[model samples]
Target chain A: MLQPLRDRVLVRPSEEEKQTSGGIVLPDTARKRPQEGEVLAVGAGRVLDTGLRVPPAVKVGDTVVYSKYAAMQVSSEGEDLLLLEEDAILAVRD
Target chain B: MLQPLRDRVLVRPSEEEKQTSGGIVLPDTARKRPQEGEVLAVGAGRVLDTGLRVPPAVKVGDTVVYSKYAAMQVSSEGEDLLLLEEDAILAVRD
Candidate 1:
């Protein structure tokens, strides 16, 4: 159990979307990174330079949209996980 | 003049790095997305479920590390720009 500290969040990246909106699976070289995931853990929150603590936007179990390049890959309990900054998260979906 | 609102942030994505860290020029097919940028605009802080206002993480003119996949490309005044969520920002680099 890796607990992120200071604006860091742990995400379980969703499976890559092989098919496009048109139902076509792109080639391996042309495949884009996945942009969605499940929220697993979050840091206390981002501390502003002014010393204000901004509350985290998403909570555990929240499905979120995240940038593909923002994640740092790590292995936790044999599961592939992504360590992301709060800033990289786009939005929470339902 | 595009003004982002509510957890959105605007960035001037830097030019793609044509050379590798080792100074080798990667071909277009092998090149990765750029992960850094200059802050151009910031949204008002995200509103919490508690109705609290979380302060923004970055300001205009700040250089930040960002996720490559998190940005939506747009043309602003003929310059390419990235519209990103505040969560996609990794860190402020001075």
Candidate 2:
């Protein structure tokens, strides 16, 4: 299991997408990646200047939607994972 | 000008992309969006539990590469913008 440190989160992106409302098959060469993923790990949250820990909101195994371009790419065990802060996570999918 | 509050950032995604290292021109519907963007706005750093502000690292107008899926979508002045946290930003392009 991977554990992110200091407000970082690990996510596995979903390899699926839907067409734009324009009905145009936007090529990958023209747009950014989608923002759908499954949570893999979460850090202990950022430490405040006062030395307090801010726990993250989402937990491991949660599905979430984030900004299309809002996390760092990391490779683990030959798999592509994302490390992001809790604030980077926009919403958790139910 | 838009001001993000509390660890949020605004980004304008770059509209260009290159072929993957595999040379496969993956269609947008098959893959996620790219992670290239220009910073448009940023929020103040998160407030610590001890009444201190963390102050974000990146600033407005900085070019950054972020996770494909790590921010929220917000609209301003008829433009699509992304609101993300500082930690979501992977790297600043020098």
RMSD (Å) of each candidate, 1 decimal: 10.9, 11.8
Candidate 2 chain B least-lDDT 10 residues: B17-26
Docking class of 2: incorrect
Best by lDDT: 1
List residue ranges in candidate 1 displaced over 4 A.
A17-34, B1-6, B9-94
Per-prediction DockQ = 0.05, 0.10
- Tell me the tens digit of each residue's lDDT in model 2 across B7-88: 7777886765222323443445223544778998776677767856798888878999876453555555686666666777
- Top DockQ model: 2
True contacts kept of 2: 0.17
Which pairs of residues collide in candidate 1? Answer: A86-B87, A87-B86, A87-B87, A87-B88, A87-B89, A88-B87, A88-B88, A89-B87
Q: How many backbone clashes does candidate 2 have?
A: 14
